[model samples]
Target: MGITQVQRLSAGALKPLAALVDDLGLAAHFQGDAMLNGIDPVIRSPHRLGEASGTAQLLIGIAGAAVWHARTGKKTDIAIDIIDALHYLHPTHFVQQQGQPILVDAEHVEVNDIFLCRDNRHVMLEAGPPYMKLLKGYLNFFDCGNSKKSFAREVAKWDSEKLETAMATAGLPACRAFSREEWLAHPQGAALGQVPVIEIEKIADGKPVPFQTPALSPLQGVRVLDFTHVLAGPRSTRTLAEYGADVLHISSPAYPDTFAQHIGVDVGKRCAYLDLRNADDLVTMKRLAARADVFTNTYRPGVNARFGLLPAQLAAASERGIVCMTANAYGHSGPWAERPGFDQNGQVASGFAWKEGEPHKPRFSPVFYLGDLMTGYFAAAGMMAALLRRSTEGGSYHVTLSLTRSAMWVQELGFLETTRQASLPERDSYPARMTSIDSVYGKVSFLAPPLTFSNLALPNASRLSPYGADVPEWPA
Candidate 1:
């Protein structure tokens, strides 16, 4: 059964959550079931995107707060606001500055929507600033009139499958739209099926270090080295930061993200710079890794592995057991495992786009960036669960998830067809869900943490800062 707006998570409700916990090998770590704090219908979406992500929030909130529970014999029984529970998934869409909603330069035909190809099929294309340099040469070939329609016209001359293959082989993000059945039959889909929805595995042996005295939040005193960009990866570390982990987000000054994106994702953490290519900078990061409790990377799986920052590498660099998380697009075991991708690519490749718009127009889910954002919630839960496991078992653990994998899991949860066509709320309609902070970046307000702890707090402990604004070193 597909989940919709659930006001309260009854005993029999949220069966999909349990199935996912078993799939991720985290059932043993869960102290008990979680619940929702408020009524739903807060988020607008056809699939159970809101409910699935909301429940994911509930899972991680309790997992992090459980650290406090372990010390004081408190049950960290938390209730996620059925409405605000989904706000964090699409932070930019709801962020406010001086009482007005912030705007993201998110639209461009070159990287924006579906294009019809020669074979009468469709392909999703993405060429964001970070990867545009690599795609420039290839995209310029289709530079007809230098207009979006001209670009679409040129795309129509190429077969969908060939165009997708060429783009992916060049390390660019592109995927042909496929129906649910067609996706299930593709090699990439078959490969993804072999991978778990989420993977949390121990990779090294070490001594257990119990949780210290509970203080500000559940993850007080814990240090997280965040080497992630954009959504999924950053959101995971952001959640940890809110729960009292000293999260230091590392980004290179060489390649910068739009200031809007930085504002959306940098909340609850200190933004710093470190060039991994520089030997001295690498040493600094290694030293920090050796002392960190959790490390998160959102780069394509092997990109950081080349720099000796992979799970096993980080585990070896550390003195004690640590939690390492890797979030990506396709998945680790697939033929397209290393393929670079974005949220819409996941939707296109995994049949969501087709499901939403078929025989007419290929469309993305109504919710803001469903695939990538939902994966963030999965990453956060996996990290907290792995950390909880490491504190008791004493082994470096690795947590892994992908946008495509999250899309597939949501399919398994079932969609609420009856509510699929419901009228939705517009932007800034609910100010109560928004939280403001006098951040280092400035006075800013955005979506709060989706879940609330009965025993802990919300709004996190830190302020948003511009990228590379802080020194590389962790807080002393």
Candidate 2:
């Protein structure tokens, strides 16, 4: 609301904007079809993750062009309104169904918060209710009257490093907090430094194929096999669906998402359950992948390989070419690649949590979501880039991402505290940004997208479905 009329990047692309993006390896993409906008501070954090929200928009702009190019051999100009994108960090906060919120139980005090250890170091131990059965092995202080305070006391008994190692050994979720300087020196962090935020590699060969059918959105008819959970991975496919991709979100009955997580990210998709451990479900997921143009999985790094769902393997799943993408907790390489991770892990390991320490708390950031939400856009951008490459380069591709990698990029955006008298993006911006759609769950409201293209429409008209509400098969 501060400025209903946002400026365009190309005609008035400010030089000050380069400070955050110069090192991101996106100048080339920026120079390409993407024309970035919105260089103002919108988020409340002292960190630049919110101000750099435009980076996601830039990626979305580029993806929009790629979708347009692949869908119809014609070029198009895309404009991104970046405010609502950062709002997506906490999808449940903004979304509502039939006046009732879809909620994942958020009160897992024993499993969800940060605690101090004997090492005097901070570590976030996370195994949300949905993941407790999945990522096991941790302190067993479960009590008749257990509280966060009680859990903190138990956590303090273990050395931070040892607890981190123990959790990693058992494939549970936890990480020792690192300051920016510490992150640079840590072995796993060092390994992360060697890679890009989003990795898009051509893994197989296929002929270029352009869409012949007419469509209202850039990704219309594009089939996306979404085998993912939680915020980061699900948000990626949801963005793809907004572009008109036919996203099929699959999950297992054994490990279910919170109702809020399902409702927030289920827009414009077919949600189904298929436990890969089961012979028939495994076959079903593969069959869907075989017909998909995009394949995404968010299991810990190597878990997909066990099910024969590796990028290269799935790249060969379709002859027409597929954009295969994956998300892990840590970076794609190094000691922590196989360890499970989540947004909090990224926040802790990438130094954001430490930097966010307050006078009352040594390490904490209320709920800043750059790690999870923008990382989703990162993977989505990678998939779009891979899709663009497929339409022109004639090959199948693989895109990789991790929570830490995305969080690191946010750090690279530079801290906003250094800027002059920065306040939050205008509260007035809210009313203009909210978009309500009538779906299966009454009038559902969520943040609108930060991008627009000439003559193209957002897929908001599509209804949101409940988890596992649809069949596994693609539409006939």
**Every model: Cα RMSD to truth:** 2.9, 3.6
**Predicted candidate 2 versus true structure: per-residue lDDT over 75-152, tens digit per residue:** 655665545545555555777777666555543445677888887888887775445563234544223234567767
lDDT of 2 at 168: 75
Global local distance difference test of model 1: 0.74
Please identify model 2 stretches exceeding 4 Å from their true place: 1-8, 11-38, 73-76, 80-82, 105-110, 134-145, 358-366, 418-432
**Residue 20 lDDT, candidate 1, scale 0-100:** 62
Instruction: Looking at model 1, report the run of 10 residues with the lowest lDDT sum.
Output: 1-10
lDDT: worst 10-residue window of model 2? 16-25
What lDDT would each prediction earn against the true structure?
0.74, 0.71
lDDT of 1 by residue, 1-476 (tens): 22233444346566766666666555554465577654334445445655677778776765665666664556545666555655555667877677777755454434467889999899887765335564574466565554567768878999998898887767667899987778878998988777777788889999987878756567888899999986788877877887778889998889766677777777888889998899999999999999999999988766686788888888987988789998888887758888988888888888877776755687876654777678887887788777777778888999988898888877766654435445555332445465688865467887655665566664346577788888988777
lDDT of 1 at 292: 96
Candidate 2 collision pairs? 81-450, 102-260
TM-score of 1: 0.91
Query: How does model 2 score by TM-score?
Result: 0.88
